[model samples]
Target: MQLKNAALYLLSLSLLALAGAITYFAASLRDINSSLPQIIDTVEKVNQNIAPLVAEAADIKKQIPAILKESEQIRVSINETIKEAEKLNSQLPVALTESKNWRILVPIIVKEAELARETLNSGIQEINLVRQEIPVSITRVESLITESRNIGKETSEGAVAGVFSGALRAPFELIAGIGNSVFSIFKSEEIILDNSDKEMILETVQALINASEFGKTTAWKNPATTRSGEITLVNATTIKKARCFNFLFKFNDQKPHSENVSTILCETEQGSLEVVR
Candidate 1:
């Protein structure tokens, strides 16, 4: 009987160990089941994020050709920019020099502009005054010219009783009226009569006067200039009671050169004044 009781106790111990192992395995399986939904949710989130990244990567791949083309264009543009920059660098110094020269001239240009403005203003007033005076001056000149013509007519017809016996009055009106210069040959100085229309000098020619009656010196000049010359007649009579007179003269203008000349005047049988030499 005692042996049978020992066998029952060992059998009970084996049954309890088997039951504890089964219960532990059941608890571990329950914990794994509870965590499965959270793991599945994490996996779903990872898939959702990864799907957009994949789509974006594919789109980027599609854009690669256009990006490469743009990059090539940008490289060409950079090369062109470099070339243009180099050209500008080469030309920059000359451009800078021109700009500097313009800068230097600015003050002078402004000053000249101001001076021109002043000159123009003054010139307008002067021009108005000149306009007013010109007509009166012209009228006086015309009257003087008419008077000179009459004087020339009277002088050319004047006959000397002793020397000019058969003298016909020769009118030197052209020579006299042109210059409008009344040159009394006995005067000390005279202005040269210039004919502006003909661009010729009007020289006065008169019959030789008695040497003692006229002065031995005369001066001549242009109307516009002060430069003048004097001629001194040293000898006037060539022969006693001769029809022709020879005059010796020494002349000087301001120049270093001087001239000594012998001039002959003949009273023709018709009583006209003639220069022989």
Candidate 2:
């Protein structure tokens, strides 16, 4: 009876241990069932992310031949560029030699340029000097002309008066009177201009010569002297490498006397108009 009691106790202990193991296994199964949804979601996300990678890999496979062809073209271009560089390198020595030869002429070219500059400066100085001297020269010329006119007039009047007085003393008063009357009738009318009148006339002439067209006339009057003058541009020419023009000047004095004179004026290197003839 003791042996049967021991066997029954051992069987009850085995059943209790088996029941505990079944309960633990059932709880583990429940936990696994709850995490199944998360595992499935992680798998779906991995597939979605890998889909584009697979497509890109296929595209790279398809472009491999074109990429290889383009690489071959780049290699050919690089080789051509290298060949051109070699050609330029080969010619560099000849270019350097030619440049050295050109360097030998640099001093000579600079010397010639300096000489040209000096010549230009000298010409400019000469022009300036001429320009400064123009007014003085004009005044001198006018003075000389006035002196000559006065001398001629004095000489003519003295000779005529002496002849008339000698004829009257020789008992030919009637003849002298007739000769004087004839001389008076045939004597040329003179238009005497003062210095102020001359200056006004010259200024007008210069302005007209510079600004007036051909066949145009410009006139000036001096109120102080009641003197008037007109200058007309008639013809244009070149003389001694200077631009020249012919002008006709008509002068009127206070008296009923007038005179016409034709003169030629030329432009000097100084750019001033001067009487040429």
Candidate 3:
């Protein structure tokens, strides 16, 4: 019985220790259960951050080929620019010389253009002056030509009259001697046909009176045709500041008849005939 008690005590002690350890384990398990929601929230936050980083890494990987291509193009462009700069340096001296030459000629070109414009303006003015004067000059020339024609016509007429007067002079001299003594013979019924013949016959009779006898004897007598009495001229004198002659005709014209006539004439102070009576 004592041994059975002792075994039973030992079993009860072991069971008490076991119960205490189980109680401690149960309290630790309660604490673990209480912190499990915070741990899960931390793990979920860490997974959320890792998922974005993974997506960004994938996007960077996708763009790598385009980035490399752009880098290569930039290198090629830089090389081409360096080569163009080298070429420009080689041609720089000649380009500067051409620019200097153009600068030197610019003033000369501008002066030549100004001179050309002035010369053209002068030529245009000269042309306008000529145009304005041409019609006036033509009109003056036409007036001169007309005046010359009129002068020539007058000269021709004067020459013809002079020739005609000279032609009648010789024939007039032949009849002058007989006409002075015989001019009053014709009657109104006689064969007097032409007025020019009557004038010629009368002028021949008057020419028979010598100019030397003007103041001494103013009398003139002429034989009559088919009449018994003679024709006479008297009063050969100056009157009214003019030379005049008076005529007396007495003859048989179907009967004894008498007529009187007067003529006015002009003469120079020297007694030379100026105008016919």
Q: Who wins the lDDT comparison?
A: 2
Q: Where is model 2 more than 4 Å wrong at Cα?
A: 1-36, 133-277
- Encode model 3's per-residue lDDT on 1-277: one tens digit a residue: 9999999999999999999999999999999999999999999999999999999999999999999999999999999999999999999999999999999999999999999999999999999999999999677556544543444355445543332233222212223333323343344454332434444445533543322122232323233333233334443444455443444443333345544333333333443333234
Predicted candidate 1 versus true structure: per-residue lDDT over 149-240, tens digit per residue: 44335443333222222211222222333222222232334223224312222231232232122345555554453334444433233233
Name the lDDT value of residue 216 in candidate 3.
Answer: 33
Candidates 1 and 2, the one with greater lDDT: 2
For 18-96, candidate 2 gives per-residue lDDT tens digits of 9999999999989989999999999999999899999999999999999999999999999999999999999999999
What are the RMSDs of all candidates, in order?
16.3, 20.5, 29.2
Q: lDDT values of the candidates? A: 0.55, 0.67, 0.55
lDDT of 1 at 272: 42
Model 1: residue 209 alpha-carbon error in angstroms: 42
Give the Cα error of residue 184 in candidate 2, in Å: 38
Clashing pairs in 1: 167-270
